[model samples]
Target: MSSSDLAAVVVTVCVVVALVALIAVLTQAFALMREFRRKLEDFDSKVGPALSQLADTAEMAQAEIGRLRDLLNIAQKVAGLAESAGAATARVAATPVDKVRSAISVLRGAQTGGTGQRGKAEEEGRETGSGGESTAAGSESRGR
Candidate 1:
């Protein structure tokens, strides 16, 4: 064969080899892409429900927090009412207690003859040298 023809044939063989390698590489790339698409679909099918469930859980937690807050508000109001009731009870009780104490003091003063001086019986007892015990014994002997 001629030298120019031989060089042309060699170039043509190398081009054919390169084309075959490119085809093989393209085929492998297409297969890899198909596997990647299938795995992505599987991941979506598995993770989609989990994502939805997570969203539902978050909503439920928010609802529970709101409920707890409402309960706390009610408890605070109840505590305030209880404190008010306690103060009212104290005020209501104090007036009656003070009135009763004053009435008892007035009764005591009446029994004591309503004067700063001693009663007549106490004055007579002090005028006599003996205490009122001797007078009570003499009265008891007379009753027997």
Candidate 2:
């Protein structure tokens, strides 16, 4: 055989081996891709419901947070009203009632003699009827 013919034979063998190697690599790649796709499908089937439930939970939490915020606003309004009521009560207590009671006392003292006014006032208070504890204290003070 000629050297050129031998060279040609060697080249043909090399090309056949390369084709085989390429076919093997392509087959392995196809099998790996198929396995990856199957695993992805399995993951989707298992985790899809849980992910949907998580989204629902998040929406519920958001709604609850809004309700809590509204509750907080109502609480703050109530607190402000309470503060205003306290201030109004303090203003009323600082003025009027004491002046009216003093005026009434003066009128009663004029009706009774000045010396007998204390006893007369105590008797009138008892007749009007007060709590049991104060009645006891009044009786004790009278004894003294």
lDDT of each: 0.84, 0.84
lDDT tens digits, residues 16-47, model 2?
A: 99999999999999999999999999999989
For candidate 1, the clash count comes to 0
Off by over 4 Å in 2: 96-144
Native-vs-model 1 lDDT? Answer: 0.84
Candidate 1 Cα outliers beyond 4 Å, as residue runs = 1-7, 98-144
**Clashing residue pairs, candidate 1?**
none
Residues 11-127, candidate 1: write the lDDT tens digits: 999999999999999999999999999999999999999999999999999999999999999999999999999999999999999999999999776755533233444457768
**Considering every candidate listed, which one attains the maximal lDDT?**
1
Alpha-carbon lDDT of model 2 = 0.84
lDDT of 1 at 14: 100
